[model samples]
Target: MINRRDALRASGLATFGALALGAVDAGLTPAEATASGQLRGWTPLPDPAAGGVTSPPFPKNLTAEERRNLKTFDELDFTVFSSADWARLDESHAKHVRVHWPDGHYTDGIQKHIDDLAALFVWAPDTNIQVHPLRVAKGNLTAVTGVMRGTFSAPMPDGKGGYIEPTGRQYAINMATVGLWNRRGTMDEEFLFWDNQTFYSQIGL
Candidate 1:
């Protein structure tokens, strides 16, 4: 006379009891026992780099140009945002590259973009970003989505000849960028988009 919900609840309680018993017998806490692989029928998550069975594979039939564009995009994200290697901008961006921000402001050239990023890093030295989970490249265009995480532990510019004191708060915001590549395998135009309100709320601004 057991309903499906009751049966599921009973099964869950039984499983928890077994786990608790196993933990006590092994002289460990329940959490420690679970983490130590005591849970029956539990499978560890597969390595993302190994492209597990559940992961959708990238297109294997990409053209040479498309592959090059994708590689360049990855390098750009690593060097420019993750690694903060401003000097290497030439490797992935044209000298005349233009970068557009969500606020409708745009950097005219690579040097200008470097200056803008430098000021940002001054505000948040621990800034680190990674592009992943969603990357697409076709012909001379590439798009990537990821999160930018950092701690606001330094004074920030107020754009009015003054500075705002550090808040020491951390923020992570989802962002996306689309790039128009040139024939030289470097980005000529990049458009970045993110929710400004979410970012400001997270940092208590």
Candidate 2:
């Protein structure tokens, strides 16, 4: 049986070579990406995790507060394409929110995560994240999946506390996120996952 990596390559979900990366770096920004744009066309083969199933089932007897919290989370997620106002995020996140990223980047508080994200927006001014159609909410946990599209327009942190100059490359990758809300209905913790190889390949790294 083909391995997961092989399967992703075979399905065209993952593209290879420096040329693929170089081509996108030649001025492809988020404004040029459409709902059916080429930059966002690479989709992985259907996986069980991404199946069209809503967790916690229908007729979700969620409380008004729960519903409101979920709604706020959705709004916050959309800020990647707009202004990621720190004060705004502060209002929606707990004072000590914990954030986890698949790449091992971790933030122990809301302010730190906001700072990190603010830097990302500066490097990729046109970054955009589009939420998936399915969202699952159960108890204090809420989950969402989405696509991230962005252009590296300025120098970016290399995850080693170092930095790399802009490559002008545009990238699109699938992302998943889960969050736990505090008693105040603000998100207190979150976990995010994405394909790092896909991202690196798109940026010609």
Task: Indicate which candidate wins on TM-score.
Answer: 1
What's the alpha carbon RMSD for model 1? 16.0
Which candidate number has the best lDDT? 1
Give the CA lDDT, 0 to 100, for residue 72 in model 2.
Answer: 75
Per-residue lDDT tens digits for candidate 2, residues 108-149, read 987788887787687788776645543555556565566777
What TM-score number comes out for model 1?
0.69
Summing lDDT over every window of 10 consecutive residues in candidate 2, give the lowest-scoring window.
Answer: 11-20
For model 1, the superposed segments whose C-alpha errors exceed 4 Å read 1-57
TM-score versus the correct structure, for each prediction = 0.69, 0.65
For model 1, name the residue pairs that clash: none
For candidate 1, write residues 129-150 as lDDT tens digits: 6535445555565555556778
